[model samples]
Target: MKNLILLHGALGHSSNFEPYESFLSQHFNVHKVLFHGHGGSEIPAAGLSIELYVEQLQQYLEQQELNDIYVFGYSMGGYVAMCHALQYPGKITSILTLATKLNWTIEGAAKEVKMLEPELIESKVPRYAAQLMTLHGENHWKQLLPAIATLMTRLAVKPLLTQTQYESLNLPVQMMVGDKDAMVSIDETLFATKNIPNANFAVLPDTKHPIEMARPELLIGLMKDFWKI
Candidate 1:
């Protein structure tokens, strides 16, 4: 079986991939990574950043002694996976990213950061806030919100990956976005796909930004097809 690593989105934990793990394991050796400050992991002293997550991933790969691995990343995880591939070439054989926001602008990031307010989320989206608390810790979840906001703000100023870098990727890459995904635009995904020499793009119908809401059959089918397993 091939080795496959599943990476969750921002504010998400390794457990979020549980739903698909069993099915994926039947075809590949499935592994999950929890970024710093997520899934009950202690926040690094330097806090959350794309560079930190990429380094964490590199450490995980080295510790496991894994190579030529396949990666499936969702949202922010997708962004981190690409960065890791760029930093450590030949480690990842291929990458599949879903609903990842590729185009980050100051205005766009500011809007996203504003939504990370703990109080506002607690007041307006109590269920989501409660989910965050459950995923992280009851007390620590609030701290994570600000840290993630800072990360987004930094991305707006300087993204980890540039157009030339995308073009330089030597491995196969597939970028997928849901047609109904409001957070990630299809245009941006397509643009990135076009830049990559060996890349493909796909759009899922009746899909949204949240991975939990995605139809399992459709997602798994795409993965199987991509991997030819």
Candidate 2:
């Protein structure tokens, strides 16, 4: 059986996989990747980029001597998975991504960037703000917000997974999103799959963004059904 690697969304940690850990481990060696600026790893000043996450993943694999793995990524993590699989092919057997917004137009970036407003986070959503501070540290979380904002701007200009790049993938790629997810449109995912030679697309019923937090088992079931494992 191939080892399973779970990649969490931005502003999230490896613990995000806690709910699915036991069940997933029963079938495959489960590895949770805590990207740079996350977990115990040192935060980089270069900010958040697919390159940063991919480098961390590559290091983890090299350190563990791992190969023939299955990758499951959420949101930003999902984007990272596609980038990684494309950049370094042989090690990854398959990839499954959820809520990974495909199209990154400048307009889309502006809307999402506003949500990272430090003032809003500190005032209206204090609890959420405190959690981030605790998880990422006061100074680092402050730095992280802007870094991610910059990353969004960068992605708008150059998406990590482009049509030409995705079409080149030789491995199975499954892209899914919640039907109710306002952040990512079904059309974008459908369009992405069209160019991906070995890709498939799906929209989960009665679900929303952060499906891992809402219905992780549904994701697991989808994985099993698609992989036919």
Write one digit per residue (lDDT tens) for candidate 2, span 1-229.
6788999887777887788788788878999888777643566767778888888898999998888888889888888888888888887888898889879989999898889987889999998888788777776776777778888888998877778887888889898988998898899888888998988888898888864445867777887887786
**Candidate 2: residue 205 Cα off by (Å):** 1.6
Query: Which residue pairs clash in candidate 2?
Result: none
lDDT of each: 0.91, 0.83
lDDT of 1 by residue, 126-196 (tens): 99999999999998999998999999999999987779989888899989999999899999999999999
Q: Which candidate wins on TM-score? A: 1
Per-prediction TM-score, please? Answer: 0.98, 0.92
Worst 10 residues of 2 by lDDT: 38-47
Q: What is the lDDT of candidate 2?
A: 0.83
Number of clashing residue pairs in every model?
Answer: 0, 0
